[model samples]
Target: MEKKPAGSSLSKALTMLNHVCTSPVPLRFAELVDLSELPKATAHRQLNTLLEHGLVRFDEHKQAYYPGYGLLALAHRTWANLDIRDVAAAPMRDLWSSTQETIHLAVLDDAEVIYIDKLESPKSLRLYSAVGKKGPVYCTGVGKAILAYLPEAKQQDIIHQQNFIRHTEHTLTTPQALEGNLQQIKDTGISLDLEEHEIGIKCVAAPIFNARHQVVAAISVTAPAFRTDDASYETMKGLVKSAADDISKRLGACD
Candidate 1:
């Protein structure tokens, strides 16, 4: 076999790691050599480096290579910091500017949504919400947006956890009710909080996806219900969804 020259050490390492991480099943040594297109000696050396660094593990029984806990640790750190806030910065600003409404970036934590980033409205009247505050997944726009896109089993788990506290008259206080609403949001790729989380507040939200097309976060544009009429909500919906899509793309989501 004509051996292809391995690129820079970093590139070679990344190429091997990517394959290991992306493979649905463990890869044998021969399979990796063929997949990476590196000479056997080169591949062996690179595999040794990866193993030493805890990037991959070799199964002695199966004679295959698989991702290691090191990758999981790194992923935990990345998710803990949640670079989505930085990726959504510009788009969130644009959405806020377009709607002149309060903007929120939230990620699902267990059954609740944690407000990780917030852009206050330029207007005098803004809803009461702050970064690090937790909100219910069943009643808040950002929360519902994320919950709606989650896997069915996860959605059920979170839904089961909700206390169904009615914050306002509009709040859905039953699992059946919330489930129907989530189904609508899942179909539309949008969510709305019609004074469900807080009285006199309303918002439009959309889910943000990661590279694997999983819903990792959400964004919302909120305003006083008195000022947000049907027509205004229509406009805000488009802006919020567009901004979420932009942020998701920045995060490497294909759709």
Candidate 2:
């Protein structure tokens, strides 16, 4: 019969929501309680509040909780507010239509890259990245494209913070190795994924400059290795760079 402040209650609810969203799989009520470390009654009450608002949903068959459609609406609104995404939409569509490959638009955030827009290919196999998901800059094409244009100090800071966990044999696991690749990307104004993020998935990417002539975002074209090879990547590199240039011009960047 004790009263808690409104702020405390809101924090508890938000914490529980994040726990459910970040879990690798749908989480049971007891699992959420354990992860959130909140009292049983308090955890249940907060979960009910979120579920009622549709921020979270319960799976009856699996008896677990996952992020709901409500989050999708919020995500849509969030991306809609980004001018870069709006500006890049047309060029992204054009590039996707031309190549029939997946297209991704991302921006550097802290030491990682956050996917803001994604156009899925008709192919059966696809990249695991999704809008709102965060990926390592050292391993992803978009990440490397942005990193190549970042100031040296900023690049070093990001590289130093990375855990360098290898996702594939092709992944660059050391700052020295990644730096070499970054230099190459800077020289050519293009970057390659080379199955570094996931096996069978490869991409070519280029950075989009803002009105201030600073790298603000990156665009990439991704395909399965089964359908593409070294020569295809070289072709993709040109396409991606051209699309990026188009987006950059729309953003008011000068030659």
Per-prediction backbone clash count: 0, 0
* Cα displacement (Å) at residue 49, model 1: 16
Error of 1 at 98 (Å): 0.6
Report the poorest 10 consecutive residues by lDDT, candidate 2.
1-10
Deviation from native of the Cα of residue 213 in model 1, angstroms:
0.4
User: Can you give the TM-score per candidate against the true fold?
Assistant: 0.70, 0.67
Report the C-alpha lDDT of model 2 over 1-255, residue by residue, as the tens digit.
432333588999999999999999999998988888887889899999999999999999999999988987876675446699889999999999988999999999999999999999987764689999999999999999999999889989999999999999999999999999999999999999998999998889999997668899999999998889768777888899999999999876889
lDDT value, candidate 2, whole model: 0.91
Local distance difference test, per candidate?
0.90, 0.91
Give per-residue CA lDDT, model 1, range 50-74, as digits (tens): 9998989999999999998888778
lDDT of 1: 0.90
Which regions in candidate 1 have their CA more than 4 angstroms from the true location? 1-82
